[model samples]
Target: MAIYHLHAKVISRATGRSAVAAAAYRAASRLHDLRLDRDHDFSNKSGVVHSEILLPDGAPERFLDRATLWNEVEAIEKRKDAQLAREVEFSIPREMTQAQGIALARDFVREQFVERGMVADLNVHWDIGEDGQAKPHAHVMLSTRRIEVRIGEAVHGRRDGIPHPERGGRGAYDLAPDPGPDGAERGRRSTQAHDPSADGNSGDAARHPAEALDAGEALAAAGRTARLIAAARLRHEGLGLAQDQPSIGFGAKERSWNDKDLLLTWRERWASLVNERLAELGPVRA
Candidate 1:
């Protein structure tokens, strides 16, 4: 039986590791970290089945080289504790052929990371498990920052763009919005307007914000209802007696995920792919 596991991590300078070393170890090749003035070599390392440096469609041709890729990352990040790279480790089902497995992995990486402007250095390995079985897996190293490739220019898509809104800066240069959610949910809306069932009573009730309030909204609504009931009961109990009252207001909308969300999202995506491939293969023979 094939297991489902996808892990994501960061290689940071705080951990006393460099991008060059991570790349060399995964690729089983040699790369020199010019910033640290040292060489990282793993050419004789074993169990490396395949390795490749993958870039977005319009990335500069020079970045095709692994050494150049990691070196650029090191050069871009100047902080002592900067994150050098993001790594994702996932299990590959032994049921699929080598070509199929590689193709699936690359497809997932390209769609999930590279398409969203990340340069991925991916490696596949075969190792012996504790039970003496062959365990095949793939490791993906990613760029920390968002990127975009233009004509002869590598654009760093910064989340914190120019013209600070809260800083009272002058020129508020408008930056392009992110291309929505990643992976399968990219460009997909939370609700569809063209649903046939939207005309029904249940669907209408479900879609209405007032009727379909979330946990926080429900809590606020319940508080308001309680206050109204308490006021009526007080008036009935004592027709002329009155006490101090407090004001109430609604809370803000729910907050979304941060850095950790991205990792979990990618992990779920990989798991989905594994299930898809298994379904395609159908039940295995005894």
Candidate 2:
């Protein structure tokens, strides 16, 4: 019997669930949750036939790794009760081969989700049921938020009197020495560079100018980062910020995905795909 089943749910912190854990379990791989500082090891877990991340065309390349992808989701969501992701579990026809099922799932995911600008983590599994029959399915974890990648250096201003990379490092407004933490203009580096006590703290020693350059360079290295802001937050410019690209994120949850009418439409689409694939196979050649 060919089955068509698609179920969707929100993976939210309010339910004490983690997107990182869900991704690791579905992929049967080990992943570290950067936000929770915990490790999820399911590498020995069986039944994972294929696992891959299908990022939207312009999505960050770093998210290609399952762990890094989910970790970024965790990082973007700061609230304790944030909705981390949406998990869509669908059944693959038992008549389909492993490769066929994977292909079908990937196609469905790409057309339904990726084309609409969502990052999907797809995992196909084939396990024996209690009846000793092959039960094949796939789990797709879709990011509830949208991705925005900007090209620039990260600027952390004035940590320990060190200038950030954005403070005019290339000689624009930055050609002159930057002001110190006290709002006073900085003196020449040739004079300040030798003062061990120039830092003006009780027991702290002054840092060399070159060390500040190293720190700034390190900040610059973290370029072209992605911001995962939810669509809800994007709409309300004054709402909770996901990454400041005129969008929603952590401001309010998106509701269109759970609409009864939309779900019905998705159900129909899934069934149509299954029927089309089976029809293409032509009655098993008798």
Candidate 3:
């Protein structure tokens, strides 16, 4: 997997100078081997120096290629002088290759400019590492001219959807239900009666409150025993103590207490054991 990065910068000539000379100066300054005096004509004049060079990784070379580079520069020139736009930068996941990153960057630039009906000759460079081990990235040089019209509109209502009338309108009172004849007095009497089957058994043979509590305690003890056994096995393996034997801790015995304090303490101890086991595994990969 590779990461994608895009960076853009503006290139223009010095004050009071020709656009051609500025463009030429910028183009020549970008060459690694070429010098101002030795390889290009801008050596003595010094009229226009490559004012700003913004190179995102892998972007420079692609922008330098004559056929494609000229197109980018043309896009920049299409924008007017007064409205200078800032450079754009973005990064994407590494799944895209160097060539793919460059293509995406070019497409993104074209879409944005086309929407504004502006054309400028921009340079895009792709920076790919040696043997392609590093993530792919790109740098773009764009013109600052403003070619598109800016429009503004006032927004009133909620953007999501229309407001619900029930929630927004004036509140209404709900009417109470009316009972049939011989109703109000009968309803009051029925509400005051006690439930006979509150105990699990029938009303005549209801179990005592103490007996029910004992049964509940017995069931809880059995469940705790099972959980203790499982926890012992996990702890033994996690600690690298006994290969097959179960391990026991103070927290397991404390379960017999039924007190909230003891139960909470045991839970904390179990959580600590879980954390220790995970820490041994080290950081997760990717």
Best by lDDT: 2
Better of 1 and 2 by TM-score: 2
Model 2 poorest 10 in a row by lDDT: 167-176
Clashing pairs in 2: 230-248, 230-249, 232-248, 233-247, 233-248, 233-249, 234-247, 234-248
Once superposed on the true structure, which residue ranges of model 3 sit more than 4 Å away at CA? 1-9, 12-93, 120-132, 146-286
Q: Ranking by lDDT, best first? A: 2, 1, 3
Query: How well does candidate 2 match the true structure, expressed as C-alpha RMSD?
Result: 20.4
Q: Give the count of colliding residue pairs in each prediction.
A: 0, 8, 23
Candidate 1 matches the true fold with a TM-score of: 0.62
Top-scoring candidate (TM-score): 2
TM-score of candidate 3 on Cα atoms, chains taken together: 0.26
Error of 1 at 234 (Å): 78
Model 3, poorest ten-residue lDDT window?
A: 247-256
CA deviation > 4 Å runs, candidate 2? 150-259
Per-candidate RMSD, Å: 20.7, 20.4, 34.6
lDDT of 3 by residue, 201-280 (tens): 45433323245447777688567757766665566567775533322110001112212333234334433433453355
